[model samples]
Every structure is written in C-alpha cells, then in structure tokens.
Target: MDKCKVDVAIIGAGTAGMGAYRAARAHTENVVMIEGGPFGTTCARVGCMPSKLLIAAAEAAHDMKHAELFGVYPGDVRIDGKAVMERVRRERDRFVGFVLEAVESFPEKHRLKGHARFLDAHRLQVAENCEVEAGRIIIATGSRPNIPQMLKAAGDRLIVNDDVFSFDDLPDSVAVFGPGVIGLELGQALSRLGVRVRMFGASGGLGAIRDEKIRDYALQVFNEEFPLDPAASVSSVERTEEGVAVTFEDGDRGTVTETFEYLLAATGRRPNVDDLDLQNSDLELDDRGLPLFDRYTLQCGSSHIFMTGDANNDLPLLHEAADEGRIAGENAGRYPEVRAGSRRAPLAIVFTDPQIAVVGMNIQQAHDHCGGCFEVGEVSFEGQGRSRVLGKNKGLLRVYGERGSGLFLGAEMFGPAAEHLAHLLAWSVQNRMTVPDMLGMPYYHPVIEEGLRSALRDLNRRLLMGPESVERCLDCGPGA
Candidate 1:
C-alpha cells in the first residue's frame, strides 16, 4: 500500500474543511486535504443558496397576492413551478461553480481524493489503496440530513431538504415533519407557492425559537397560512403508487388520513464521523459519539486529532463551521503550543415570514449563563407604526438583559426585519455593551428600528439602569 507523510491533513473539503486547509497552509506547506464527495459546500449546493432562491420566488408571488392590503390590487397570481425550479437550479449551480473554482485553484499535490478513516491516531486509510501518516489531523467532514427510520416507510416518496431543490416541478401536496429550521422555512415557502402543505413536529417547537411567547406567535401566524401541528399525534405512514399516506390527528378536525405526493423528513442532521472509525483514533467520544474537544481550542482530548464544524456538532451554522475549522487548523498547525481562537457571538436566523432570530443566550440559556439575574422586555409589532405603514404589523420581540449590570445579553424575536435586528444584537453582545449603552445609539424615526429602541427603553426601565429612552419616534413610530 502506498503511504505518505504530511505535517497536516484535513478530511472533507466542505466549508469548514476548506477553511482549515487555508489556515493550516499559513503555518505549514506540507498540508493535504482529502475529500470523498463533491467540492461545493452544503450551503452552496443544498442548504442556504438554493433554498433562498426558492424563497425569493415565493416572496415575489406572495407580495403580489398581498399587495391589496396596500390598496393596490394585483391580478390573480399564478405560480410557474417549472420556471421556479429552473431558476433555483440554475442559480444553485452558479453558486456551486464559484466554490468549485476556489477548490480547483489549489495545487493538485495538496488535494487528495477518497474517503478517509482512522487507522490510528497518526494514520489514515484512504479508499483502501493509500494510507496517510501525519503529524496532525483535522476532521471537518461536515454532516448529512438525518431521517428517522420510521420515516423510511414512505420509501421512494420520502425526501429531505437536499431533495427539495432537485424537484423538476413542485408536488401537489407534501407532509412535512420537523418544524425546525429546514422544515419551517421550506414548508412555509412551499405553501406560499401554491403547494398544499401540512407540517407536523414531534417536538413543540418552531424554528430556532425557545421562548414560548415568540414560538407561539410564530406558530399561530404560520398556522393561519398552512396547517401546522407542533406536537403531532402520528399513527402510521405507508406508501402507494400515488405517494405517501399519513394518518394523524388534526386537532379540531380530529383524526385525518391524508395522502401527499411527498413526505419530507427534516428532522435534523448527524455528524459525518460515523464512517471515520473514530474508535481507532484513541480520542475520547462524547455522549453523541463525537470526539470530545475544547469548544474554544477545538482540540480533541490531548491528542493530535482535532475535529471541527458539523463533525464536532457544537453549532452547525455555516459561519460557525468556518470559524471552528480555522481555529482547529491553527491549533493543529502549532500542535503542543495550541491556543484558543476567538469566536463570534452566537446567532441563529430562520427565514420564515416575520423571520425568527436568536442571538447570544436564548431564553432557555439565560438563567444558566446569566446566573438567574436577568429580566426581559418586549414589544408587539402589531401596533408599531412602521409595521402598520407597511401592512406587516404582527409578531413580537423580546430582549433579555442582566439586572444590575444591565448588559445586553440576548434576544429572541419573531418580527419584521428580524435578520437585520439580530445582527445588531449579535454585535452588541460580542462587545459586552450594556443595555444603557445601547439605548444611547441613534434611532432614525419612521423606520423598523424604532421598534428595537422601544424594546430597549422598556428593558432600561425594568433594569433601573441606562438613561430614559430619548423621547423619540413619535412621528413615524408605533401608534404614529
């Protein structure tokens, strides 16, 4: 068997693996990246980019339908499934092309093709032909869509988020399981695009929201558009020539049997570590069977093996994966002198209408992280002036802060412009800015941001810190 040695070796050339390769090259020239699958990232190929394309199409259709609320009537809206899928696939391929260009630019000598599994702490077997021995190894194989075995009963009728973008034409109806990020975003988008959708979640959760108030508000809004059962009582699933048959209780409608052209399983994702034979790596595994590692340093135990990105399963967002990959690579390049790398504040956004954002600590984590010395302040956008003016007045925003320190810790919001709002909150939390400090920032009147200021003012009052909100936003603010 052919064998090779390198200062550093990285497995899987997805977003995180690629980031690790670039970072490691800064410290050592003897680096190699092994990838068994396609070069494009999950985001470019299946996760973010393609999904957003579909959502964009849905948004256009939805806006035209709702324009009457503004006293401007648009005629009957008809969806072109073929054209929508074509654009989604075309644009998706374009984004994937960009990533491919980046990968192909690397010298051939630095790239290895084949799946790799651990032979030992310092060695790897690649596709049965070659073996790699390295001073340090970084695992960034990423993850795949996870489906429960029961869902497999749908057989050929079952699909996942990765399969959604590949449809040549939209299905007539779909039964979506899991109301998490993938299910909620795609389910809502599909519904808006004229597909009959029924979403069922075994867990009583919606999007990434943990706060009951925000989650319930989103749940109500979504159900108004499509049928959603956050806590479903599903009894059986079977497949037939037509599609999949699902039997479940539909609340007021009681038990109902529905047949859908497709059943989408968006339950969650599992790491790619299973095939790597981690048992041979001599690294301690966590309860999830992933290698135990330092969250800050990305080192697995005290060994030369390091894991990051979805492989570590800490936070699977694309940006988090990239950050962890760079940190792991930097530590691997330096070995014994490993140092912890800086990480950005936690932030998650779900792109459903009214959006959903969770920044820094969520409601579930506030007490644990803030020592139970936190308070919450909120505002309902139903009466917010900008929202009413835009005819998008609905949803809520809840901000959390420390009692005495009055620091802006985190927030969970389901409201208009939540994606933008979350970014500002994330920046503030990373800076450790207190609520009083945030209240001093500028607020342009008649904008959606005034809603944020109102919430901060309420938070300041509750905290008994920070100056009273500058008497502002009357002209174009809530109740204006």
Candidate 2:
C-alpha cells in the first residue's frame, strides 16, 4: 500500500475537480486528484455538448420539414438514423478526447486512479491502492442521474441521458420521463429527428422556468411537437417482451397503453457524496447526508474540508460547478484565510426549440426578494418583426424589475434567440443595470433584441424610471 501526505487533495476529475486542481496547484505543488471514472466533463461526456450535437441534427431536419412554409417545398426528407448517431458519437468522442488531454497534461504523480472515501476528517482511502492524508480536501465527485424505483420497472429497457449519446441508431420510439432540462432537450430532439416520442413529468414544471406564463407557453409549444403531459397520471410501467410498456393518461384518450424501445429517466441528478462514507467525517451534513458548505466559499462547516460542483448540490450547472471548484481550491490552498469567491448572477438556458433562459431571479424570487415591490414587463414574440419574418413567431418573454430602484432583477423567456438574449440580460443583471439604463442602450432596427427593449420600455414606464417617449412612440417601431 502506498501512502502520501499532501497539502490539498481533490476528489473526482470532472470539470470542478480539474478547476480545483489547477487553482490548488497555484499555491502549492503538494496536491493530488483522485478519480475512479473516465477523465472528462459531464458536459463533454453526456451533458451539454453531445446533446447540442443531436439538437443541431434535429434542427436541420425540422427546418427542412418546414421549408414549405417559406414557399420552398422540400420534396422528401429521409432521416438516416445511423448517420445521425454516428456523428453524435464521433463528435462526442472528440470533445472527450480534449478533456482527457487536459488531464494527461497534469503531472502523472499528481493523479490517482480510484474511488476515494473519507477514512476520517483528513484521511482518504483510495480503493486499497493508496492512503492519502491531506491538510485540506475538495470533493468535486460530481453527480449521477437519479432514477426512481418506479422507473426501474422498465428493467433492461431503462436508460438515462448518459446512455443516449452512445446509440448505434435512433430508436423508433421513446418514452421520456421528466420534463426538465435533459428530458425537454432530448425529447424534442428525438421528436424532431423523426422518432415517435411521448414525454411525462411528475410535476408541472419546465426546466428552470419559474414564471407561470413562460412555463405554460413552453408546455404548449413543446406539446405541439410531441406528446408531453406534466403532472401525468401514470398507471404502471412494466417490461414487455419487445420493449418497455407504459400505461398513462393520454388526454382525451383517457389512459392508454404504449410500448417504446426505451424509457429514458431524465428525472434529475443526485450528488455523488453518498458513496464517500461521509458519516466517518466530523463535518456537518444535511439530512440527505451532503455536507453543509458555504455557497460563497465552498467551505465545509469551518473544517479543513470543502465541497464543490454537483457534489455540493448547490448549483448543478457546469459553469457554476467550475466556479465553486475554483473557490474551494483557492480556499483549501490558503487554509485558515478562506475568503469568499465572487459569485455571478444566476443564468440557466434550456436548448429546446424557442430556447428557454432564466437570468438572475424569477418572478417568485423577485417578489420574495423585493417584498412584492416588483413590476413585470412582458413581450409576446408572436408580433415581433424578426420572429414573424423568420416564421418563428411563437413564445413569450417576461422581465422583472424592482419598483423603487427600478433595477433589472431578472428575465425569463421562451422565444427565438433566447440563449443570446439571456446572455445580454445576465450581463445586465450582473452589472446592476436599471431598466432605464438598459433601455438607453442602442437597439438596431428589425431585430429580435428590439423585443427586449420593448419589454424594458414597459418596465421603465411602469416603474416611472425613464422619461416618456417623445416622437412616434408605438413602443419603438412596432416592437422594432
């Protein structure tokens, strides 16, 4: 058995772990990273990147299918399922390769290959190969998909988002459970790619969208693409001779039975801290057994330990995970002089059609944060010039601002180019821009961003923040 002492030890080699490793190395060379799984980011292996590749293919197919709307009829659209899966796998491997290269570039002595669990507060046992005693620790072990026992009834037919990127060919049909980010994106991509898809959700929610208007608009828009019933009444799920069989309420059809090649469990993810034997440690833990750590510092209960990434369960997004890892690593490296890391405004985007983005606070969050002293500014893309011109005229956007300060609190949207718009709004929120300040920015003619300006104008007027328009008003050139 090999034994070593290090100043910092980081568990897991995903995005967060890598970031922590880099940050810790800056302060001292006495650092090591332990990972039991493959060296690659979740975004690269199974999360964002591969999913976007599939979505790109789906978008191509969808545009070709709808070309007739532009008076250019595409005679026949034949989807090569094998080809689609091939490209997804090929590009996915390339992305994973880059991550592997990064990990390999680190000193081989700094890498340990095994699952690590806490022996005590400062000791870690790495799969019988090595014993590590460190002054400080960072748990960036990441997360795995959470599957309920009910979905286990699908037996061998059950799969998760991680398994989708490795398909040899697209299945004929899929029954996707969970209307969250993974489910919505994969379900819509499959539906658009000529696969019969039925999506179900236990609760009435759409990804990170908390505003009721955007949620309902998203639900309606996506259902038109595939059968999605949030708050669904699912009777049973059983393994059939051919595939997985699911019996559920199908609107007016009233409880129908359907069988699909795969039953995707996109429910959610659980922190990977469970297998770490956290009970042996002196650190404080939540009821779920996860460590109670400071969000700003990623420090675990005033102890020498820290938690970051999905392991902490604070914010599961890759960017947030990276940020937390950096903070945790920096604090762990400097020990006893832990400082708060700069946290950016919240931003989330779902890459579905008419994409969904939530920046800063939602309506409920705004109201709670401001004690109901907030006003809403809204815009429907149905009448927006650019959206209508592009035949993508659907969805809604709502921006929230404080009533007194007129500060741009947040914005949520289900519309074309929402990902781009969300970035702009996220920057605005981070900069503490007011409604009038945002409106003062130049908006060019005949653009979707004019929709944002229109909403800002409404918010400014309602908050009495900006002077009224002087010339040919009409809310800036008919929604610009």
Candidate 3:
C-alpha cells in the first residue's frame, strides 16, 4: 500500500472541509483533501443554491399570477417544468464549477480521489490502497439526507434533495414528509409552480421556529399556499402502479391514505461519520455516534483529531459549517496552544413566501433561560403601511428583551422582509445591544423596519427604565 504524510489531512471537500483546507494551508503547505466523488459543496450543488433557484422561479410565477391585484392583467400564463429545471441545473452547475476549479487548483497528489477510513488516531486508509499519516486531522465530511427505511420500498418514486434538482420534469403531485426547512421551502415552491403539494410534520411546528405565535402565523401563511398537516403521524408508505401511496393519521382528520406522483422525504439529515471507521480511534462517541468535541475549540477528545461542519451535528447550516471549519483548522494547525473561537449568535431563516426568521433565543429559550424576567413586544403586519401597500399585510413580529436592563434577548417573526429583520436582530444580539440602543437608531417611514421599531417601543414601555431616564435619553443630543 502507498504511504504518505502531511501536516494536515482534511476529509470531505464540502464547504466545511474546504474552509479547513484553506485555513490549514495558511499554516503549512503540506495539507491534503480527500473525497470520494461529487466535488461540489452541498450548498452549491443541492441544499442552498439549487433550492433558491427553484424558489425564485416559483416566486416569479406567483407574482405573475397575482399581478391582477395591481390592476395589471397579463394574458395567458404557462409554466414549462422542463425549462425551469434546466435553468436551475444550468445555474447550479456554474456555482459548482467554481468549487471544482478551486479544488483542482491544488496539487494533484494532494487531492486524494477516494473514500478514507480511520485506521488509528493519526492514520487513515484511503480506498484500500493508500495510507496517510497526518499530524492533525479535520473531519468535515458534511451530511446526507436521512430517509426512513420504510420509504425505500417506493423505489424511484421517492426523492430527496440530493436528486430532486436533477428531475427532467416536475411531478403532477407530491406529498412532502417532515415540514422542516427543506420540506416547507420546496413544498410551497412546487405548489406555486402549479404542482399539487401537501406537507406533513410529526411535530406541531413549521420549519425550525418554535415560537408559538410565529409558528401559528407561519401556518396561516403556508396554509394559503399549500396543504400542511403538522399533527400528522405517518404510518405506512407503499408503491403503486401510477405513483406512491402514503397512510397517515392527523389529529384534526382521521386516518387518511393519499396517493401522490412522488414522495419527498425531508425528515432531516445525519452526519456522514458512520463510514469513517471512527470506532478505530480513541475518541468517545455520543448516543448518535458523533464524536465528543468542544464547541469552542472544535477539537474531539483526541488532541490530534478535530470535528467540524455537519459532521459535528451542532448547526448544519452552510455558514455555520464554514465557520466551524475555520475554527477546527486553525486550532488543529496551532495544536499544543489551542485557541478558542467565538461563534456568532444563533440565526436561522426559512425562505418561504413571507419568510420565517429566528434570531438568537426564541420564546421557549427565553422563557427557559430568563423565566418571567423577559418581556415580549409584538406588532401585526395587518395594518402596517408598507405591508398593505405591497399586498403582504399578513403575519406577525415578536421581539424579546430583558425587562429591567432592556437587553435584547431574541426574536421570532413571520412577516414581509423577515430575512432582513432577522439579520438586523442577529447583528444586534451579537453586539449585545439593548432595547434603548436599538430604538435610538433611525427607522425610515413607511418601511418594514418600522415594524421592528414598534415592537421595540412596546418593549421599552414595559421595561423598568425610569420615565426620567427615558425622557432624558429622548432629549439627549445626537452625539450624546
């Protein structure tokens, strides 16, 4: 067997792996990256980029259909599924090409083209032929969609994100299982594109927003776009001559069997660590078989091994994976004097019609951490000027803050321009800004930002800040 040694060995060429590779290379040129196939990162190839392409197309179709609201009626409207998929694939390939080029830029010998398994703490066996010895290792193998074994019986009728973008044509109808981020996004997009879509979630929430009010608002908005059953408990899935049959029980509706041309299993994802032969190492495994690693340092129990990205199963978003990868790579290269890394405040967004955003702590987290110490402020978009003008005057925004110090805690909202609002809130939370500080900032008239100001004003009213202090601040000079 061939033998090789490197300063750092990164397994998986996805976003996290690539992030680690770039960082490790800064410390030493003797860095290598290994992957089996499908060189593009997951976000560009399947998760974020391709999904957004479909969503954008669906949004365009929806806008054209709704143009009548503005007294502008364009004649007949038709959608060609084949053309839409082709555009998505064409644009997606461009993004993937960039990643492929970056990977190929590395020396051919440094780019191992095969699966790698752990032989020992500091050793790896690649594809049964080559062996690699590295001073430190970064495992950023990313993740794969987790489909239940029961659904495998459907054969080609079942689809996951990995293969959904490659379809030659759209299905006539689809029943999406698990109304998480992927399920809701695709389900609504397909519905807008004229495909009959139904979504089911075992839990009582849509996407990852746990705030009850925000979830209810999301349900209301999503219900208008497509059928959603959050209380559904899937019982069975079977193949049919024409398509696939699904049996499920809903709290509102009794046991029902529905047939759809295709089934999408967005049931979540599992870290790609099972095939890495982690058992051969001394690192302790969790109940889910993930390595026990420090969140701040991204280092596993073994000093020579580090875990990052989706492989750690902390936050599976692409941006989070990239940040974790940088942390892991930096610490791995700086071994004995490991440095801690600070992560950004929690920020998650679901790109549905009105959009769903959860910045920092949600209601449940705030309640659990602060109990009654936190005050909630809210505003409904029903009467908001900008929202009504744009025909998006439906949904709600809720902001949470400490009652005494008025420190911004977190926020969850379902409203127009929610993505922007979520980022503003996340940035404020990261900087530990207080409610008064936010209110002191300028809020443009007839803009969605006014909704945030209204919520903050409500919070300020409930805060313990004295009236004198409030007045003093209100009358203070601009520089003060």
Model 1 agreement with the true structure over 60-101: per-residue lDDT tens digits: 999999999888897889899999999999999999999999
Q: Count the backbone clashes (under 3 Å) in each candidate.
A: 1, 0, 0
Tens digits of lDDT, candidate 2, 332-449? 9999899999999999999999899999999999999999999998889898888888998897999999988889999999999999999999999999998878877877767898
Whole-model lDDT, candidate 1? 0.91
**lDDT by residue for model 3 (317-410), tens:** 9889989999988888778668888899999999988888899999989888787789998888877767777887787888999877779999
Q: Give TM-scores for every candidate, taking all chains together and pairing residue i with residue i.
A: 0.98, 0.98, 0.95
Poorest 10 consecutive residues of model 1 by lDDT? Answer: 471-480
**RMSD to true structure for each model, in Å:** 1.2, 1.3, 3.6
Q: Could you tell me which residue pairs clash in candidate 3? A: none
Query: Against the hidden true structure, what lDDT does model 2 obtain?
Result: 0.91
- Candidate 3: Cα lDDT at 178: 84
lDDT of each: 0.91, 0.91, 0.87
Where in model 3 is the C-alpha error above 4 Å? 250-253, 466-480
Who wins the lDDT comparison? 2
Candidate with better lDDT, 1 vs 2? 2
Candidate 3 has an lDDT of 0.87
Deviating ranges (above 4 Å) for candidate 2: 469-477
